[model samples]
Target: MTKLLLGRYLPGDSWVHRLDPRTKLMASFYYIGIIFLANNWQSYLLMFVATMVMVALSKIKLGFFLRGVRPMIWLILFTVALQIFFTKGGTVYWSWGWLAITQYGLTNGAFIFMRFVLIIFVSTLLTLTTQPLSLADAVESLLKPLRRIGVPVTELALVLQIALRFVPTLMDQTTKIMNAQRARGVDFGSGNLFQQMKAVVPLLIPLFVDSFGIAEDLATAMDARGYQGGDGRTKFRILQYHQPDIVAGLAMVLLTVGLVFLRA
Candidate 1:
């Protein structure tokens, strides 16, 4: 019943929260690139240290960050197992019939697991501090040049905005539906894998029905307001990149360079 995918946004007055969404988005991309470019334990350790500093600066609780990672533990474990059993280089640590564990595999698995965890943690932190509307605005502004290529940047932004906005709402609805089913003697966790999946059928039906209903209502509301797409739409609040954003951008660039140099 716990919706782990719906990570909670913790409001804070930290430097990260003050950053322009566009800057944060670009930084996130650079950070992920650095994470993947890291090839050894030393570079990975440095990246981890840098990420921890960013986390501390964000002022969001460490507990929240760990909680956001809980859902991914199984996936991390699975990757670890796959790498440990399949990677054939280095000294063999264990051998049992067809299954083998090699030192190289273990190291590779651990690195990959940590890499995925850091990527998720850092990206989720960005989302935690950013408002969905602000993200939409930032994305729209960033993609404005695509308009020259006949791409509908405004429509793309609207879709991203709606998707972000609906995430929390959908999570809430799922919780409500699960609780209602629980009250009606439906047990989601008390059955075989197949049976448990079957239990979700009832939940899925209502979820879809309500999703369509909400979409219809939203369309009606927009239509009532004479809403038109991408046609001279004016914003009351314009996004501005300030000095702090510039500093953050520079820091991200430096971080990227440091990470690459450390790897080399």
Candidate 2:
């Protein structure tokens, strides 16, 4: 959990690091949506290459991006396995009662796995390269038009940034809780599945208490600082587009066209 980097930012001066938050944020979402357009190996390969290129541009180690996927590995495999076993089409490689492995099932399973990895990699790239606060600004800017309909865009953005920022904090807190419990003779790793879950109960209670206390303290600090809601508030930093953002936008456009062309 501590090694997970999904919501954590790493400061760098790479090309990807310098992209406008709006570009990165929108591109991440846009890439995810276009992933569904991939139906065959050609399209998947193209998307995979594009994703890897973006990762390479970020100049972060591939291992860090991989760590982001590690925590979700089980879930990904379970889902891919379900798709393989339950989905039926093409040639039947094996069959037993209601379960069957077919050619189409294998293909679809591979596609699903690729989809999951690609999405996670892209998302991890966004969070790693862009600060949470910058993401909040991008989200607020993009959703500003919704303010006309009385939507609370500023508050929503604040919530998003806070959630992102707290992920690392909560992870660190979990690590501390585990360590403290371990010192008192709680074994987290040496047990069966049910036993491990039962052991986690001791960890969660205190963690929740601490989390609530932290939240309360934060709220008090905000109150003490006379922090009002985001209406008529000014930003300390303004987001601006640059050549890199334009390049990124164009890259996304080209990737979209390629995927459309390559989709089976």
Off by over 4 Å in 1: 1-7, 159-226
Cα lDDT of all candidates, in order? 0.85, 0.91
State which candidate has the highest TM-score: 1
Question: What is the TM-score (0 to 1) of candidate 1?
Answer: 0.77
* lDDT value, candidate 1, whole model: 0.85
Q: Worst ten-residue run, lDDT, model 1? A: 1-10
| Candidate 1 lDDT tens digits, 1-264 | 223433455677899999889998888988897788887888899889888988998998788778768889998889889988998888998899988999899889989988988998898888889876887898899999999999999888877878877887888899899999989988897778999998998899999999999999999998898878876888775788999899988887787787788885
RMSD in angstroms between candidate 1 and the native structure over all alpha carbons: 4.0
Considering only N, C-alpha and C atoms within 3 Å, which residue pairs clash in candidate 1?
Answer: none
Query: Which tens-of-lDDT digit does each residue in 86-164 have in candidate 2?
Result: 9999999999999999999999999999999999999999999988788889989999999999999988987787777
Model 2 earns a TM-score of 0.76
